[model samples]
Target chain A: MAFAEFDLIDTYFSQRMEQRDDVELGIGDDGAVVTVDAGNQLVVVTDTMVAGVHFDQDTPARAIGHKVVAVNLSDLAAMGAEPTWISLALTLPSIDQDWLQGFTHGLREICEYYGCQLIGGDTTQGPLAVTVTAHGVLPHGSAIKRTGAKPGDWLYVTGTLGDAGLALAARQRRQQVSDAHYRRITDRLYFPSPRVALGQSLRGVASSAIDVSDGLLADLRHILKGSRVGAKISLDELPLSLALTETLTQDQALAYALTSGDDYELCFTVPESQRGVFDTLVAHTASKPVCIGRITNEAEALQLTLQGEPWQLPETNTGYEHFASPIEPSV
Target chain B: MAFAEFDLIDTYFSQRMEQRDDVELGIGDDGAVVTVDAGNQLVVVTDTMVAGVHFDQDTPARAIGHKVVAVNLSDLAAMGAEPTWISLALTLPSIDQDWLQGFTHGLREICEYYGCQLIGGDTTQGPLAVTVTAHGVLPHGSAIKRTGAKPGDWLYVTGTLGDAGLALAARQRRQQVSDAHYRRITDRLYFPSPRVALGQSLRGVASSAIDVSDGLLADLRHILKGSRVGAKISLDELPLSLALTETLTQDQALAYALTSGDDYELCFTVPESQRGVFDTLVAHTASKPVCIGRITNEAEALQLTLQGEPWQLPETNTGYEHFASPIEPSV
Candidate 1:
């Protein structure tokens, strides 16, 4: 027999998804509310994850839960907003108590780490999917936007990329990988740490920014489009992790890093004059920021290169899209 | 080939889910916002629908789109909120333009009619499920809750019930019915008008209230538990549609009416001394309210009677739940 609503909620989610702190009301309430910083404007974002589209069915529940919330928070981080509250709409094929518990446990862990509160949400029987609406706040006019970048801005990213894509490939192919490498890749896929502090620090500093949920090229194109400018990107400067270099050739690793999605590390632009200041800020903080390219005044379009040779990349976007199906596996 | 993200959004939802005055941004943006009356506190609710669970694949896409938002708005209506804005997240199997167009078209119609706006949401590829988060506002402290009922408060419901249940039965049995009756019954399942005006009108006047999404018995049990009271409900007073009464015996109709869910009407309690005022208010409204029973301060339980004899409704709620199997016929 399928689990009842009360049982599934109580056993899997009730304990894991309830509010903590002076947030007043929590789960079981029709609506939940908690006070935000009185001086800040609230920022809200929503994202949804669908089974087989967002993640394969073989994906672990906890990872799926963590990744869903992580991606949404990544939006807030990119906007330089402080994460505050979230609500979820979880739909499942059947009452899989174990899966629900795993999902909520991962979600709770992330929320607790990020100082976010779970306010409220709706649950219904459906094809497996999870939609999370997250709330954040930043001082009025302080939130970062893509339209802020200008000519001569230095483009940068935090940490390496493509480990997630490699991990996905390995998993899909059932390849035997070193446990350490597999762990590294899965961590990249599942637990993308939103650069919250780094973003908050960039508010008055960075010209414009966005998280790299899409491939670097696609996302940077968004910045270029929004800012009405062009860019001179250096493929050689693309940050590759030790894991990425160890497992693949430089060209292959560079290809994957340039186009891999799901790496929630931020890609931002700072005025060239502030480059020294940004370097100092990164030096002062635990998180390191890497300057990879520069924004240009010319509007000819993005020019990707390695040592000045024109670079080639995939014609389509990486990972899932709301409108389209996955690219046919080339491997 | 899978669809592209922009194409997916445009083909499925974009034109159909157009912007309204209340919307500061819509589908194309990172997030969306709707302004609320500063004097009124916001009431928010979310609900999800899955293709095989909450609805069948054969179900009209327009109905699915409309019902997704309608259910959440029903909660706000139960709270006496003025419907204002909504955000939607949809996951799909493959991008199907026709389905999306129909769905969004239906959704926009409701938004226009209810004076609400589409704010923002995320679209990702996945299995078929839709999640909608709706926001509304009501005068601070005037939004009725389910815990305020006291002894001697009269139980009332707006409109009739059980028609949707009969309609479902008819559909399953392939029974033909008159067009007018069919429209009325199907409307219960599809276009549930959230009692926003009536709920807002009853703001301080009604003692407590809830939306009749679950059967009256189960929903009343929720209020009784919250208020620490019992209720003596008269089955005879249950308002039944003429079509339902004409088709089924009183007992069968009463059973469906009492236990059937999906009646998106308001069920509330008002003090007896305010009967004249309540009556005046109801008589002036489009959805006429009917007295069904009285609240009694006692051990928590709900007792229903036809001519003062006992009647047992469904002990467990079977209306809808998250992560449960899809309704059998739908599957």
Candidate 2:
């Protein structure tokens, strides 16, 4: 029998979420009900990944599912919030049982790893797109924000950058990489993990933070605009994976790191006094962040240097613009 | 200049939502932070309406915008929760400044009317679709659910049925109607009002509740299945709008009322003792509910009667099933 909406939900999403005491009532109702703990506030974020527009049409269903959750969870991570619950609005052209199984498996894996519950959602028939809304909680007044960065603060970003961009470039035949490098680059593009631990750990340590989904230049510019500060970065300090560097020239790697998108890593700023402590705190983590620059007092412009000399970016290389830029494959 | 994602949001969604104290941080942040008032639980629901599948390709952008919010709000009403905040993930083929204006105008009007804030959202480029995730609040233990009905309760439905269904039939040229009737029926299809006040009033008075989206029979069947009971509905007691009755034959109207979807009215039940008070509570509303039947102990079947005679519906009439049903224009 062809699965109806309800049946599909039952087979895929309904029973897999872990039990949570705060979720008083869950799926199967018109709405899900939960209680927010006394001293914590709720954090809400949403992101939609449209097939063909957000990823390749031939991408694995599991990868699409993982990317959707990871991008939204990355937003929560940027806020220094603990993910608690999520709801999905999935639209599809038709039902493919194999695709559904792979999708659910990926979704379930992320929910389990994050200790988040899938509360409720809607499944509809249409163009394929997955919109995920993630809810997280943080102590009142403790969540980090982009507007908190201050002049003179040190800038840090978790994990290596540009691997996902390199993967995309290679996929589009705009660049090439060896097979060994191709696997690592594609893995980063397809299954980039959200920096949840790093963000949670930065609660009282970072002055401001954001996740790099629109490349380093674009996302850091958002922090500068919001915090009313500028930033000075040394191009040589940008963290690039060995796989990325081995596949392209230094300039090409730098271009990808600076202008390409979909690296779901937390980019944050910390006061000079907190630098030592923050470094030590993140030292043992799998994706320890590295300092690359300092927040500056120049109200609206980003300053750049390469090996002590002034460096200027091409005017068109300012990262992805959803409306102005052509659709590019990314997590 | 072409509208970028950020510019479109700023021009339409950001400054329109009413400021609320509970919203510690609103739009422009990676995630919004809000507090769920103490003593009340949080209710969350999500719905997505795709272009062409949910409505006509040429439907008014304003109406498209209104229906998305209205449908999601109906879910909140069915839970007897007061809406507090909403987040939207809007995907579009491209940005049209005029359409964005009209759409946001419709969204803002509803948000202002219902006191819900558009806290945050993501705008992406793709085939057109709107996904809204609404959050509401209710007293700790007062949320109405489909599982609470009993064998002796009275079944009631708010507002008239069949109008939206008739509208869809006419749109597809399966039925004919006069111009005046066309206006009325299409209005219902495009802009059905959510029974927010009635749902809130039904809090302690209702035994079980569900919003009638997938026709009277289909939605009531959900309650019956959930409550582990059956219902004996009087076919003749169904409330039909004058426009619906004038547009089609009596049998057609009845069939539409029973099998057609998109009538976003509340179908609920109340215990025998609460009937009198419940009637008084809803007496002054714009769409007063009428008693149509009584709940029964027949575990999993729905009984039907028309003017004291047992009636059997044709085998083909059930209701909308996302994958099985044809696309119909609906609010």
Best by DockQ: 2
Error of 2 at A153 (Å): 1.0
Q: Which sections of candidate 1 miss by over 4 Å?
A: A16-24, A33-39, A174-178, A272-281, A314-331, B11-24, B33-40, B174-176, B272-280, B313-326, B329-331
- Pairing residues by index, what is the TM-score of model 1? 0.91
Find the candidate with the highest TM-score and give its number.
2
Instruction: Report lDDT per candidate.
Output: 0.75, 0.87
lDDT by residue for model 1 over B1-331, one digit each (tens)? 6556655655555664445564443555445433444445556677887766667766788998888888888888887888877878877666676887778877988887888777677776656778888877776667677788999999999888877767766766644567788878987877777787888888878988888876676577778887888999898899999878888777777877877777878789998888888888878677789888899978576777888789765345435334434256253
lDDT of 2 by residue, A1-331 (tens): 3356778888888875676889988888899999998888999999998877788776788888888999999999999999999999999878988988888888888888888889999998778899999999999999899899999999998889988988888888888788898988898999989999788899999999999998889899889999999998988888988976887777777878887899999899999989888979987998878889999998868988889888876556778777654445342
Candidate number with greatest lDDT? 2
TM-score of every candidate relative to the true structure: 0.91, 0.97
Candidate 2 off by > 4 Å: A1-3, A324-331, B1-3, B328-331
